[model samples]
Target: MLTRLAISGYRSLRDVRIVLGPLNVVTGANGSGKSSLYRALKLLADIAQGRIIQSLAAEGGLQSTLWAGPESFSRAMKTGRQSVQGTVRKSPVSLKLGFGGTDYGYAIDLGLPLPDSTSKFSSDPAIKSENLWTGEMMGRSNVFATRSGPGVRIRDDSGAWRLAYEHLSTFDSMMTHCSDPHDAVELLRLREQMRDWRFYDHLRTDRDAPARKPQVGTYTPVLAGDGADFGAAVQTIREIGASDEMDEAVADAFPGARIEVTSQGGMFELEMTQHGLLRPLKASELSDGTLRYLLLVAALLSPRPPALMVLNEPETSLHPDLLAPLARLIAQAAKRSQIVVVSHAAALVSALDAEPDSRQIFLEKRLGETVVLDGVPPSWTWPTR
Candidate 1:
């Protein structure tokens, strides 16, 4: 489980570190940088998949994502004695993201590419540095693998540093370029764990949503990000996962409700049977809130849980009465996987607060920067380039 997460030079998260628990609830008002924190974690996951550059580009390039604030705010600036303005940059352009768990930790540093008039991708960001360390915190002595620019090094079995790659591409991550089981076992383990981190954000439940259509039946242990295979996933859960818990979840959300997956010509469709209904309601006929709740049930009851699961604004379109049941489902899922729920629903937040070992992080903006107001942020350090 990731115990700490750190981000810098990214949007309003100029410098933010969060301590995580088995179940974490992140709550904040509008423009409080809750979305920024969620996106930052997604970027970190993208790094292990060698898509960080592409993700940044999708967000309008590094220049647009970088914090639009002074390097530091002095006491006079806070008091309004000094006007807010840009000062001479004391360091190079850098955007860093990292997370640490009990077993290992990883950090990546991205910066502007060197000026190259001949290159059409000059605006692309460069991977300035990457580091992998053992234990919960990263330090010079604990670092087992280090990447500086295009070069990479890993500590040998004898605790001696050796070059792993002389030249890697600026866009490639060491997790993809240099991870070897024998050469860098920790790096490989961390990379695999990162790849398993799942995220679900605003699953579509429109009239023509994919989940509304039947899909080929297969034993799906994991729910797709778009929830297109909603029937297969739920069926799989009923077959091999916690079927009793799933039934309880459905009945808890909708009294007298029972879900079934029907197969016709190899295609599976989800249906829900409820009391006083002449016929069961198919996925296509269910309301948006009902479909979304079922999707969440499928996700939370996944047979193969991920190392981490992040849900963004899960309470959207959900009725207030359902929030309590949703909270119960989330707490149950936390027993199997670490969960981070970013939500604005007070009832949901209050419900989740009842779970043991659950932690709440309240974000607030101060001087255009995101900060944690509930308690002190976790301690962290970035690798030097």
Candidate 2:
């Protein structure tokens, strides 16, 4: 499980570190940087997928995504005696993201590419440094793999640094390119863990949502990010002996309600049989809230859970009564996988705060930067650029 998360110079997260637990609830007011934190986690996942550069580009390039506020707030600025303004250069422009877990830790630093008039993509950021270390905290002695610019070196069995790659691309991540099965075993393990970090944002339940349409049935152990395989995923849980848990989750939320997945011509469809209903409601006939809730149920009850699962604004469109049930479902899921929920719903947050081994992070904006108001920042050290 991840013990800590650290991010700097990214969006409103100018310099933020969060201590994590088995289940974490991130809550903040509007514009308090809740979404920024979610996006930062996705960015970390993108690194392992070898698409961090493209993800950054999709968000309008690194320059646009970097912290927009001044580097530091002077005493005068804090005292409101002077207006906040940019200061002279003290360090290179860098956006860093990292996480430390019980088994391993990884950090990456990104900075503006060196001036190259001949290159059309000169505005793209470059990976300045990447480090993979042991344990839950990073230090010089614990680092096993290090990447500096285009070169990467890994510590051999005798603890001697061996060059793994001499000409890595700056736009690519060592997590993907340097994870050798033999020479960089730690890198390979960490890469796989990162690749399994699943994230689910707001799921659509509109008139034409994919979940409402029947898709070809297959043995789906995990729900898709978009929830297009909703029926298959639910049926998978039933076949995998999690039927009781799934039924309980449904009954807990909709009292006396149960779900069933039907197949026709190799396509699976979802239906809900609720109390006092004339007949079971198909996925297409379910209300937005009902469909969204079922989608959440299918996702959290996944037969094959990931190392980490992140859900953003899950309480959206959910009724007040459903929040408690949703919280219960999330707590149950955390027993098998580390979970992080980003939400502003008070009821859901309150319910989850009562769960054991859960950590609550309340974010607040200070001088246009996101800062955690709950606990001390975790111990972390960034690799040099």
Candidate 3:
């Protein structure tokens, strides 16, 4: 499980460190940077896949995503003696992100490209430094593998350093460049763990959604990001995953409700039988709330859970009454994996908080920056950029 998460110079998050628990709920008011925090975590996942650049571009590029405030507040500015202003280059502007876990830790730094009078890539931001180490916190001695610019160095089994090929690209991450079967076991293990971290934003439940239509069934333990294969995924859960939990989740959400997957040849469809309805309803006929509830149920009851699961703004179209059921489902999933929920719904947050041992991290905006008020704030030293 992740013990800590640190982010700096990303959107409204100037510099922040958050402590995490087995089940954590991140809540705050609108425009409090909860969504940006979720996106920052997603960016880390994208880095392992070598898609950070494209992900940054999709969010209006790195320059726009950088914190719009000054690099840091001066002591004079905070003492009512001076106003907030920029200094004369104490350090280069870089966006840093990292997390510390019981078994492993990682950090990455990104900065704008060097100014080149004749280069077309001068407008792009490049990944400057990345590191993977073995410990809950990153320190000099715990560093296992390090990346600077395009060069990577890893420690060999003989307690000596081994240099990778000297031609790694700045656009690509060290995970993609230096990871091999024989060298850098820590990087390889971390890459696999990063791959298993599942993120679910909003699954489509519109009139044109594919879940409303029948699709060929295949055994899928994990649901797709867009839910295009939701039918197959749920069906697989009933067949191979926890069938009892699947039944209990449905019954808990809607009393006297029973669900099944009807198969005609190779195609599969969702069938829900309610108390009053004489005939079962198809997935296309279910309400948006009901469809979304089932999607969440299928996700939570997966037979194969990931290293970590993140759900962002899950109450977008869900009714207030469904938040409790959603909370129960989430708590069930937490039994097997670490879960982080970033939401603005009081009902959901309260429901989750009511659990036996859940943690809540409330965020707030301070002087145009995001700060995690875990408790009475304390002095924190951010990673030097």
Q: Show how many residue pairs clash in every candidate, following the order shown.
A: 0, 0, 0
* Best first by TM-score, ranked: 2, 1, 3
- Where model 3 places Cα greater than 4 Å from the true spot, the runs are 75-83, 376-385
lDDT per residue for candidate 2 within 151-209, as digits (tens), equals 99999889999888999988989899989898898999999999999999999898999
RMSD of every prediction: 0.9, 0.8, 1.8
* Clashing residue pairs for model 3: none
Candidate 2 yields a Cα-based lDDT of 0.93
Candidate 1: pairs in clash: none
Give stretches of model 1 more than 4 Å off.
none
Q: For candidate 2, give the lDDT of residue 335.
A: 95
| Candidate 2, superposed: residue stretches over 4 Å from native | none
Where's the lowest-lDDT run of ten residues in candidate 2? 374-383
lDDT of 3 by residue, 1-385 (tens): 8878888899999887888888999999888999998999999998888888899889988889999888888878767598777767668878888888889888899988778889888757798888888867777677778888878889777767777757777788888777887888789889889888999998788998888788899998988877777889899998899998989889988999988889899898999999999999999999998998898888878789998999998888898988998999999899998999998999999999998668899999877878888574323334443
| Candidate 2 residue pairs that clash | none
Name the TM-score of candidate 2.
0.99
Question: Per-residue lDDT of 1-385 in model 1, one digit per residue for the tens?
Answer: 9999999999999999999999999999999999999999999999889899999999999999999999988888888899888888999989999988988988999998889899998879999999999888998688999999999999987899999999899999999988888888888888899999999999889999999999998999999989999999999999999999999999999999999999999999999999999999999999999999999999999999998999999999998889999999999999999999999999999999999989999999988999998778888888888
Better of 1 and 3 by TM-score: 1
